[model samples]
Target: MSERTRYEANVCVLLHRAGRWLLAVRSPGVAYAPGQVGLIGGHVEPVVGPDVFETTARREVAEETGLDLAGVDLHYLSSELYLGDAGQPVLTVTYMGELADGIEPRVAAPDELSAVGWWSLAELSTVENCAPWVPPLIADAERLLRRR
Candidate 1:
């Protein structure tokens, strides 16, 4: 890795309702993490100025899931920095918020996602069904929620 290598930044937000969490299946063409059940998020683009992270979270969540997160305050859960499968540094900031009582996520970006569904928290005990990075963030959300 070059000392001057720039890391790509992405935001991931988890929404939980009725003991199930929202996730999407990546279509086989994305540059990273394709074809795995992963969070509802995307890269942090520079359009949203001061609140870059939060804005990116809102945009990605809406664009990818068709869920209008307007006024849904996102709380930070965790972050991880590591080399992607392509050996480039990727930084993912994880956030969590409750899925509103009656609202649900749908597949809004057909090209980027193949399907969208909720996964049982219990079913996620094993990592086979999701990206390797998912479990820890979910654990962090659970831990923090427990403390509330």
Candidate 2:
């Protein structure tokens, strides 16, 4: 049999403000996790050169949530492999960071996201239609936040 396709690299940002985490509602037309609450992020573009994971995370957060992570300290949270909607393997790198003071999230990319909101850990866990990766990522983010 032919070799399996290489896994796509993606990055996710768990943006925290006060005691809440930022989550986006995926656009209904999106290929992965459509209509579900999920972290703000997207695929790492190959053309972006080295250190693209963090670059992509920053870009995606701005694109999807209209928030700037410029001076925020992004702490690496975790990484995992999961299948995308197209049945391709994706290696997702997750990062956690605090939202800069006085900034609020809005749905910046209407085609990619429908809404943006901040949720506490308990609130996030109670969301019924969240993406599968959300729960674990939230737990990881909680630990990271605690140490801050």
lDDT by residue (90-148, candidate 2, tens digit) is 89999888876679889889999989998887886678888776877788778766776
Q: List the residue pairs that clash in candidate 1.
A: none
After aligning candidate 1 to the native by TM-score, how far in Å is the CA of 90 from where it should be?
1.9
Judged by whole-model lDDT over C-alpha atoms, candidate 2 comes out at 0.85
Model 2, stretches more than 4 Å misplaced? 1-5, 85-87
Per-candidate clashes come to 0, 0
Badly placed stretches (over 4 Å) of model 1 are 1-5
Model 1: which ten-residue window has the lowest total lDDT? 120-129
lDDT of 2 at 60: 91
lDDT of 2 at 45: 86
